[model samples]
Target: MPRGKYTNHKGRNRRFTNPEELEEQRRKDEQERRWRQQRGDESSESEEEEDEADKKKASGSKTRGDDDSGSGSEDSSESENSDEEKAKGVSNLIKIENPNRVQKKVKKLSTLNEDLVSQKPQLSRREREEIEKQRAQAHYQKLHAEGKTEQARADLARLAIIKQQREEAAKKRDLEKKQKEEALKAKTAQTQKALGKKT
Candidate 1:
């Protein structure tokens, strides 16, 4: 139905009154009508249900409280039965047999003087890896402590180049990750027709 005259950006015929086009338009209008009707029916049914519940509550309030006590007790017993069944399959994660024993363990660990321990302080995972790399490069230096200074210098130069290359690679990977996230957002918007929904 040539209802509006806007350019066909995606290059379909600008006029839309042809039989196939009219049928497609009719289908769309029918779908929209069904959606609106469903929403309206749901709202009316809920209003009726709420009114019925309010009427029942108003009538119940006039009765004596003791009249519903029997039903309340039955509900309480049913809930307790279900709770017991639920507990049968449940297990506690940490069983604390004696709280005092845990306190003693904490005290013993804390009371030890730091300086008295002859062992070297432990390195963290990353620090240990860097330390191992430094040690391996310095091994050639140790043999040449009394001689051959040029070999030690060459080894240190090589280690510096390796560290620089690793840093550059890390930066490249971070840039790629950001590009991938942007592409995914664009693809999701296209697939879900979010741009069309806004219109």
Candidate 2:
């Protein structure tokens, strides 16, 4: 006699007799309510426009399907032509060019120098310097803790040798550059003298 309960001929209650079914129904109802709420947030005008667009698309697809069914070979050719036209239209609408080729020419001494400058390391210069200083200080402290005073002096001597070697390499490079410039100047002068003699 309950409002939603029905007594079968065997006198069994049939209203939500299965708990799993009741839970499933509740879940479905909840999902539907959420979907409706989401749909309700959009403006009515936008919703109507979307509905009209969908209806038009549905009708168009249905007409295309009917045409394909009515005339098989002709419809297939038309569809292919339409696809090609669509592709052409899209390609015309979106023009793509290579960014590097389009940009201004970059003057660099060498690609190696460009790569070195452009490549970003994980740590910044200041952070790397700080880390190196901390490591060196830790190493010096460890040496002093071990009472190896001579080892610290040897480390300093090694660093001085490294510095001297770097300075010598720089000077050698400068000398080579100067030599190349002088050789170029002499070659030009010889060419000028030969031209004068010929004239």
Worst 10 residues of 2 by lDDT: 61-70
**lDDT of residue 87 for candidate 1:** 31
What residue pairs are clashing in model 1?
none
Q: After superposing candidate 1, which stretches have Cα over 4 Å from the reference?
A: 1-148, 194-199
For residue 18, what is the lDDT in candidate 1? 65
**Estimated TM-score per prediction?**
0.25, 0.25
Give per-residue CA lDDT, model 1, range 1-199, as digits (tens).
Answer: 3458774557565664664574465456445544655687666544544553464354332111212222356558746644553432223211235436745344454346654485688889999999899998788668667446787668778989999999999999999999999999888878779556641
Alpha carbon RMSD to native, model 2: 30.8
lDDT tens per residue, model 2, 5-48: 67556647556346457446545644554465567744653554
Q: Indicate the residue-level lDDT of 109 in model 1.
A: 45
